[model samples]
Target chain A: MTALAERPYGGSRGGPQGGSQGGSQGGRRSRGALALMLPALVPVLVFSVGPLLYGILLAFTDARSGRNTETSFVGLENFAELLSDGDFWESFRIGLVWGLSVTVLQFLASLGLALLLNQDLRLRGVARVLAVVPWAMPPVVIGLMWRLVYHPDAGLLNGLFGTRVDWLHDFSLALPAVIVVGVWTGMPQTTVVLLAGLQNVPKELYEAVSVDGAGAWRRFWNVTLPQLRPVIVAITSLDFVWNINQFSLVYVLTQGGPGGRTRLPMLFAYEEAFRYGFFGYAATLGVAITIVVLAVLGLYLWRQAREAD
Target chain B: MTRALKHLALLGYVVFLAFPLLWLLSTALKTPQEMAALDPTWIPRRPTLANFADAFGEQDLLGAALRSLVVAVATALITVTLALPAAYALARHRSAAGRIAIGWVLVSQVFPVVLVIIPLFMVLRRLELVNTLAGLTVVHVTFVMPFALWMLRGYVRAVPRELEEAAAVDGAGRLRALAAVVAPLLAPGVVATLLFGFISSWNEFLFALVILKDPEVETLPLTLVRFVGPEGVARLGPLAAASLLATVPSLVFFAIIQRRLRSGLMAGAVKG
Candidate 1:
């Protein structure tokens, strides 16, 4: 933290200068600050907000793909279809399963790795970057790598283990296989966040508890858990959001195949819009996915707010 | 756990983490017959570079890679240029409007990229950027700017505002004060954000896949995904070769600068 403000003039020169700035200067500067903000706001509104509002409008229309389909206004027809659609509901349920499995498992494994890395081990620097290899890889590449490994023939998983299992194609194993890769590629962010959180926990708390005859587990429970709650909350919330929308990996790995068992909501929507020429219906799916993601975020913020109170 | 056990566990992690890349390397070097051999050797008994020759020669990925590079560079340049001023405002003003902007950016992160695609595609179509690298770069600017701005905000906050004030007190103009005082200290964030924006644009697939219909305009990721058609999975050797080629730049970049990235993120976490 000190590295940020480690300027030579920080402590000594700051106070004397503030006194010379008159009230009139402050007013002009605040307006100038707003002017400084203008460029970013313009693009954010144009590119981000404008497209988003247009997307929401698109969801309520009959904007199907291909030349034969006409673009006409429809009031929640897409949504009503989604409500009764069996495949859509199935994907939603699987989306929750996929999101929870990846997020929860990713968080636990990252915490464990973070704790290990925090220790003064041999080759600590090497281990740190090694763990990040998968995280740094593009999902398309990672998905392909695993695709080769999970092959039933000429495959390492089967070759090394002496078993025959089609990891990506099997009905029961595909989702789990996808989730395992999800944890592998998603670990670095959580580890970095938790490690950052771990540093904030004071050494004296552990020392004082040790003197009171507290064991390692007790110190961890009393000192570590309480201190890391907010960070944990933030990281897991992000993990859930990320995992829920995961598409490219699954798309490359299985394309939501084996009867759509591993099809995430994003993949489902992508297939709908692009594959089946159902652009309007796909827009509804996208909105539904957003609502679920926003709900997850909303719940986290609410809980955090309550905790702060 | 005992210290020996701890070291052993670390070894396990290293092996587990390194295995896939190792396997990929082994595959990339193996002969086509060896890849199809009943008993695949862990080590390619006779290594070959023919697959890479095929990938670069026949598939012509060099052109696709060059296209990816142009898009990545453009995305990084535009994102950093815009993000610097916006992040500066958030760091300096701390007004109610700034808070709302930050919140809005965070909320945008959770919104599905799919939602952005349809509308973004229409806009790009209208502008005739559908298959153009320029269009892909513009779309990436929107996708990447929010996170870049947020991270830059943290880095900007870490810079002491007084340093700029001290320059302004010397009768320097506002732009001159920023160029002199803030820009140098802003180096770490800029470099980090640049790498981030570059890597992200290089790796982006969905929008590029949608917007760029013609093979001539395809980026690296978009071209790579084409290997999975009805032809028995692009032949493992060529696939592995292409993947490794695509993998090196971002992986090396991450290994080098992850510490700076972590510290910047932690600073942001501390504030939140």
Candidate 2:
């Protein structure tokens, strides 16, 4: 009985020791991975997540500029005010129009351009390089350049037609002017993505369509469009997000102006916070805009996921 | 008939793309009289470099350009440095968490910089970093890092792990194998990421406008804005000249990187 109990106890102890060692090794590996990840994660958490959370918190408080002491818990007063403000609603309308027009125009133009460039044509390389220039330009510079071109006197547009018309100063034309610049600046990446998609399409398929006596239009509609559906969806979704968030072009060109003609949601938020000193209201706008963007993005992502299966 | 129509359409598009740039160059070279002339001419009569000189003289354009360069280059370098290791981990480490991390980086790009500007401004103000080059660089790196990580992650994943493993078996550590066996192969991707980050940072305006309020710390775009204040009459010739000068660095940078932006590099590298 003594020998049997001693042997069993010794064996159990040995087994536990081995298991503990293995557990320690696993723990060390996980710890090592966490250590490697912490440096990258810390800044993102502190700067990215921290500020976003603070902005959300500030939206609920009566935060103001200058004194910084006026911040008190105002509850949903900011949201109610933003909801009632005609200027905020106008800005939202402008943003919606701006986003829709820019996305549609840019996507179509870029898709066409990409398709054109994908062909085995002379000067394809040169055209591709030229296409990227507008996108590479600073939005402020683009704004200023277009503003110059749209100037009533001594501007390129008026000069070309020999008819002076105020582009920015006119309420009707200001939003359209901003949209044109948006399309120009956003075309390059969409073009590149579509071009990549086009290249992925097999040559044999095109040849097969040709053998079936399909013309260029028929081939493009049947073969190319289906092949490029994924890319089209991706680029359109990205363009929407970008257009919705755009601030620099509108800021520099119109400053939400010509009697508040081109005020985007972001521009309105900026003016409220910085120009008008309504931090809480501005934060509400920010939150609203964020929700809108996420909804749009979420829809696209869900569709993509569904299609992926 | 179809071919003719296609050619006409292509020509029209090309003209649309090229006209604004051509007009800018023309305005820059035109004499003040020519620029202000009622009759618009495609080419400047009595073209002169006086506008260019005036643009340089009227503002610290050169100094601003230099500052922009420093900020862009520093941001690119710093972003690439921080992103490289993280990208490697994301690409090579096959796990659920790694996938989530990669997705987060992509999602972060969608956040408008304007939303975070208030907090960033507050932080920078408290740190006494506003209006400083370092402040701008930090803001730039924060903005550029997500995209750099996304792009570089794709590139790094393209590199074959077997090559690194083979090197590891020959008595090299993981870091050493990464440095010697994998990095050289990733040169194109590295260049692409660096160029993309640099250009994006260089062109950034909103943060620069709010943060760099001091005239001494102003960038090219801000300086150009100063040329067209509400009170002052717009100097069409000088402003056009200045705008042209501002575009030069980006144009040059894009030209340099255009050749390296082929599609199959990532797909080919990963598959091989």
Candidate 3:
């Protein structure tokens, strides 16, 4: 279904409307198209693209968050200071760990749930609705709901286990605890996408494999995994990007507490710019992290594309 | 035995997915004393409407909600209005610029928000739009624009060119054909995009946190976060109640999209 949905619209237009166009006629039509595009283009240029370019430039200047502060170009100074900034390094490492682990775990769990929901099972209707319910939730609310679960004394986790662990404040436990919530929060969309992919898999291939005396495991291993590869690559990379830049969820959950154990890159950048007022340095951090994330994503996608061939 | 095991596994997944929500519902209903209990029951012993009442009365939740509603509605309407024609152009009239527009949408999604928000703050401050709902609304509209355009483009592509061509043959101009033939066909997609924009703006926190630093101008998500005080148990019920209230719009959105997904108009929207 997703594969069909993703098919581009360029090839299918072959009619009186698509052809029989004169050169001058095509030029006039394109002019009209450009005029139609202008209203949306203006705001996107002024607000989105302009800010992004200016932000990269701001990384090299001494732009503090106050007026009367003279801004000057300080090329490599912020980067130099960032090199020795142990807190920034810690947060970067934590961000990678959080992003990678949560994404991997979320993919695995969602795959299992998606496969289960794809089955001809009872209560499928009820379970399917419950599965995607989290996608409807606000991130802040998901964080708060998990916070309630992970609370020390009166929380549900403690009550369920009859234990008294302060999950969010315990230095060693905080990251893992928050990672659980991350996995849970991201499962719904991942599951939905995977389920869509699963539904698109050819049933006849499974039947053929079954006739060859292949068991359930063999059929799934031979058919499902390869068929779902494109979707897996797309979703995991997207999930990684979303998880690493995540702010509001962890902000509400732990606020990067327990001595910055769960301080993802965005939270670290947020604290730097908003909490401590280091606009230039924070912009540098933001630019640096983006470069790293893109590099990682590029490498991953390149490998996946190679594998797909 | 294998069938039983599969059922058990499915049940386990359901419980894992639903338990936290049930816990939230239970917590929202419990009294302060029940909340403070060392052994919190899965079901509240004496459920009350007190927490909902308290949450409503405690903060300026209504004002924040109104602000959030205004921002979301404006963002949705403006985003769809701008996106519709652009989407039509991209779909029906392909150009190099259209390809570039799609590239921008994908690039915008991958880039970190920090990189954009810092310079945007400076821009807003220069215009003296900081701490204003209009500023936040502008930011929300732009933030949701790329995806809105992308999604609407898919919807536009779904409406066959033949319909518009037939309308053109009937002596209608391009704009008339669009209004008369394509717009009605694109209604479901437009609504989906609008609700998508509305929900995105409504649930937004990081931008609102930065832009609306003045508490008087805080949105619902910001105000909801404030319900989390240092004091723990006493504030739990009201926080739970308020959190639930904050989620109503999104739930309504999900309900609409769920129905659309069943009918097949929302597959591209979900992918976006």
Q: Which tens-of-lDDT digit does each residue in A153-271 have in candidate 1?
A: 76788888888898998999999999888888898888888987898788998889999998877988889888898888888887898899888898888989889999889989998
lDDT of each: 0.82, 0.76, 0.84
TM-score of chain B of each: 0.94, 0.92, 0.93
User: Residues B29-61, candidate 3, lDDT per residue (tens digit)?
Assistant: 999998888888988888998999999889999
lDDT of each residue in B76-185, candidate 2, tens digit only? 99888888877776665534566566666656656666567776776787798989989988888888777677667667756666788799889998689988999898
Per-prediction count of colliding residue pairs? Answer: 0, 1, 0
Error of 2 at B247 (Å): 1.5
- Runs in model 3 deviating more than 4 A are A1-8, A12-21, B230-234, B259-272
Better of 1 and 2 by TM-score: 1
TM-score of chain B of 1: 0.94
DockQ of 2: 0.28
The number of the candidate with the highest DockQ is: 3
Q: Which digits, one per residue and each the tens of the lDDT, describe model 2 over residues A1-309?
A: 111112222332235433555777567656766766665565556656677777788788887766545568989898898888898888888888998899999999988888778766555666776677887687877877877777777788886776778888787888888788888888887787778778878999999999999989999998999888766777787789889988988888877888988988888887777777777777788888887788877887788779857
**Pairs with backbone N, CA or C atoms under 3 Å apart (clashes), candidate 1:** none
TM-score of chain A of 3: 0.94
TM-score, candidate 1, first chain = 0.90
State the lDDT of candidate 3 residue by residue for A1-309, as single tens digits: 321453455453454544766888788877887886676467567767888889889899989889668899999999999999999999999999999999999999999989988998886787899888887888989998998888887699988888889999999999999999999899987888888888889999998998899988888899999988877887888898889899999999988888999998899999888888889999999888898889989999899889888
DockQ of each: 0.52, 0.28, 0.53
